[model samples]
Target: MSILSGILITLIFLGIFISPIIGIIAGPKIQWNNQMKDSCEYFDTRISMGTHFPESQYNIRSLDQSVHDQTFFLAPVFAPQADITAKYQYYHRFSGNTANTAHLAIDVDLENAIWRMMELDGPDERTKWAAVGRKRDNAALPAFENVNQTVIYNGTIEQLGPHLWIPDFMMLIQGIDDARQHCEIEPFIRVFDVQGAPIEYYESLIQPKWNWSPEWDEYLMMRTASFGLGRQRLDMCVRENNFRTFEFEEDKYKGVSDISFVPLAIIASYRMRFSEIGRLDCSKDIMDKARDMI
Candidate 1:
């Protein structure tokens, strides 16, 4: 072939051979770039933070004092109706008191305060693993084996029915009280997040279901809180680079002797009321009301 003809033919062949490869290679890169850009924009337009808890030393005494004062006034708010027979009967089953039933009005102000601190610290920076530490020898059955084989086997089978009868009830009551108190204090936390645009919201995806009695109820309540807070914090981390991801550390709170002050995880999912680009205004009324309630 003539020089020009050969050159033209070669150019044509090169274009045909290389074009598909170029397209294949560039396709994923282009898509990835677009996704990265979109993600960056999504996070940039919204405020988010990693999981974190307040680093300040938590004062249990102060929290207790606050609870004492608040409960003193609020106790009357939940005052038993003139006829508390029904209420008494309901709790009597749990409390095991037929006469002069014990009234349990759990105060959750401490829980709220702890949660607020957690929110302020953000989820990204907080530790994930809860250190349960060493619990008292509270196990009902001593770690002893019966000499009689039949009796040992029967005892094992019988004990399988329910493990947490009383503790579960206590935890359920505590969780309910905690949730109510959290609702009361939510407004304050909103103010704390005012500077940043609201983080991208996600509906709570985790739910607790109860199949057993007290244990089921207690587990559901605790799981609800943990999953709810975890979802919220995860979304925040995804939306805004401010919050840290959760990393569970084993046995960190293991030595803690105070059962009441044991560390607990919080999880919740929320949706942004407005688009990321939308304007946000803090509500003074809400803030004021929350402060007053506190």
Candidate 2:
């Protein structure tokens, strides 16, 4: 090849390599930020969809229909967003046959389950579990779409029978007590766009009928971390006779919740501000016009 032709090719290759650097230098002067429309407008569009919101009459049912030994409920305090919903389930001892004492546990969606699975299994060991699922149906679980009328969170809580009592606090369960006694659980309600990005986040506090166990503190913390909640070990903690164990591992308590139902008070408290999580149109472009000194 001629020297000039070879030199031209070399310069072309060099320019390609340096173009990214040049763009980086020039990027600061160019405003690439896309402008989005008002978030409230998006919420307004979603509200126009006309879906049923949470009402005072919360529904509680059994995750396990066969036995129905234990009952659970994920009663929404207010109207949730179309995409995002807040669910709360606890163990109910007043349901079915206690002869077998079988606990029915609910599971989170596959995606969240995989995350917890990875957390428990070290990074190195996760690959094996991922490969374990062979069937297509058992493969990657589908993302939660428009679950119009289904409760998502499925953790259980057990009310300590009026037997055990500690002077320091309203001690119902031994070996597993936390400061959550009579604590107001204010769950942050987040609404996500079609792209799975959260567009709006608000708070709604559920008034506790009874003090929750310390075991649930972590569960509550994790549930509040996302607009979409997941399932955990929905077990029960009961006050057997005069003594109470940290947590009851019996099968009957699985998916069992024991939160008391107070219709009027719960409805009143929830109506304070967030009565309904309005929907929004995430299609518009909004921009931040702030000047950064840096």
Candidate 3:
């Protein structure tokens, strides 16, 4: 064969070899980029933060001075009927008395999520891990929409039956709902449709506060969550990995002791809303878990 003919033949063979390899590396890179974009846009907006920092914001001070704790408060509570769902109306928002104490419930559609777990997609940014699948834990949910097929078909959860995703904090929320049903006078309760993200991009969406800890200041979060102006410190969940060293394990700096401030924020807000309901103890288990954390 002539020199030009051999060169041409080699070029053709190389193209065939390299094409699939390029695809193999590029495919995940492309998906990763898309996920980053989605997570970025989702967190940057008020969708995630509005669960606490509302948009149509009526002052928590409410133009009422008897209520304290408003110095540096950033996570002001959204009024019960405000347009919290301005971006998506799939949810039903309403508030009324369960017996005498104020009771607020916002039943989320269970089909949308802030991160979406790469499962369902839509306009709402709720913690809608329900309807994703129906496990015995979630039989109360509506018919299975199979919103998230990835987890159900994956053998690990197959035997557990179709499982739904409920955040750890909802245990407290649900327990509060029960306490309101039977207890005497209790602080008002609001079941937020919100998931755990913030107004800024974080490394993990699944974690409380999306694991946004910038330093080893969980103690700061605990102290701040109870104070009006201090609640902004509650914006972090688990301590950053860099803080998870010998000191953290030995309790020098504290580990996940404050498992999450999400619960504390809920409880503290209840105390604020009902100034008389001091030491709000609706859910014993949850309150115990959050006692020191709050």
Name the lDDT of candidate 3. Answer: 0.26
Query: lDDT scores for all predictions?
Result: 0.21, 0.23, 0.26
- Best-to-worst order by lDDT is 3, 2, 1
- Candidate that would win on lDDT: 3
Model 2: per-residue Cα lDDT over 102-206, one tens digit each: 221122221121100001111211122222322346576433332112222233223233111121212222211111121112211211111111223101112
TM-score of each: 0.17, 0.19, 0.19
Compared with the true structure, the alpha-carbon lDDT of candidate 1 equals 0.21
Candidate 3 scores a C-alpha RMSD against the true structure in Å of: 23.9
* Alpha-carbon RMSD of each model: 23.4, 21.1, 23.9
lDDT of 3 by residue, 1-294 (tens): 699999999999999999888768676655434433322211110111122211121122111223231111112212333565552234222111111112222222221321111112221212222212232364464443332212111100010111112343221222232223323222112122122334232212222222222232222222111112211211111121112221223222222222222333333333333222233323333545556698
Q: Which residue pairs overlap in candidate 3's backbone?
A: 135-162
**Clashes found in each candidate (C-alpha, N, C closer than 3 A):** 30, 23, 1
Angstrom error of the Cα, residue 203, model 1: value is 5.5
- Name the better of 1 and 3 by lDDT: 3
Kindly report which residue stretches of model 1 are placed more than 4 angstroms away from their true locations once superposed.
1-9, 23-30, 42-294
